[model samples]
Target: MAVVAVSAGIMPDGYGSDRCWLNYDRGFIWSFLGPVCCILGINAVLFIIILILLRTALSQMQHGPAHDKLIKMVVFKTLVQSVIVGLPWILGFFTRSSQALDVVFHVLNSQQGTFIFLLHCVLNEEVRKQFRSCCRRMTNKE
Candidate 1:
């Protein structure tokens, strides 16, 4: 799917035609929107699947203490992260390309990595312990 989208991007409608190709300059909609839409579509489908699985898990754990709260927290976090990561790109579709927008877009774009790392490691008890243990082991070795 990615290969197809990339191929489509590289060989857009105007490619190889001197009159319209313009030296392979990919237009905004083709280069950005196409891939962005494809990725967002894929993510949406995956999110639906995740919700289904989470629903099943919740149903199974209905009697367990605090499981419901944990499930809600997970869902809320997922939704918030999705909005944070996706909102800028979606808004970019409407806003014109400007320095301000570029800065905003890049900032939002770069935050995903940091956010994911913090979410998965810093806020996660198991990962935080493992990270600290690795740090201790390295220091001890040194």
Candidate 2:
């Protein structure tokens, strides 16, 4: 799609094109359609993964507490991933480049890492227990 847009002169070159900046230009809307479609495609894939996870979780719901926790974690991760990946792209469609938006974009970009760390390390009971044990060992050494 991007290659076609570029070849058709609808999209600007990455380095040499003035349209690389966040201003409107001729064919800009058509050019942006490529990335817009890409973003939408990504969201669609994520949605499918979320649906699969939900279905699997539902089927395992009557199994036990483990499945309950897994389901909750999967849902939380899916929501976080969507916001982290989708929000900045959606906002970019509205705003031009700016200090505030740049900061926000960076923050949103990092949220996936933070959320994953929290989900796997902080929220997991087993990881928390290991972390606490390591802390105790360190403190005892001190």
lDDT of each: 0.71, 0.68
Q: What's the lDDT for candidate 1?
A: 0.71
Q: Which RMSD values do the candidates have, in order?
A: 5.4, 4.1
lDDT of 1 by residue, 33-77 (tens): 667788888888988898888888878875655786688778877
Over 4 Å off in model 1, which ranges?
1-28, 95-98, 129-142
Error in Å for residue 107 of model 1: 0.6
Give the least accurate 10-residue stretch of model 2, judged by summed lDDT.
14-23
Reference-based lDDT, residue 87, model 1: 74
lDDT of 2 by residue, 38-95 (tens): 8678887979887897887588567688877777777776776676667876666545
- Let me know the TM-score candidate 2 reaches against the reference structure: 0.65
Model 2 lDDT at residue 33: 55
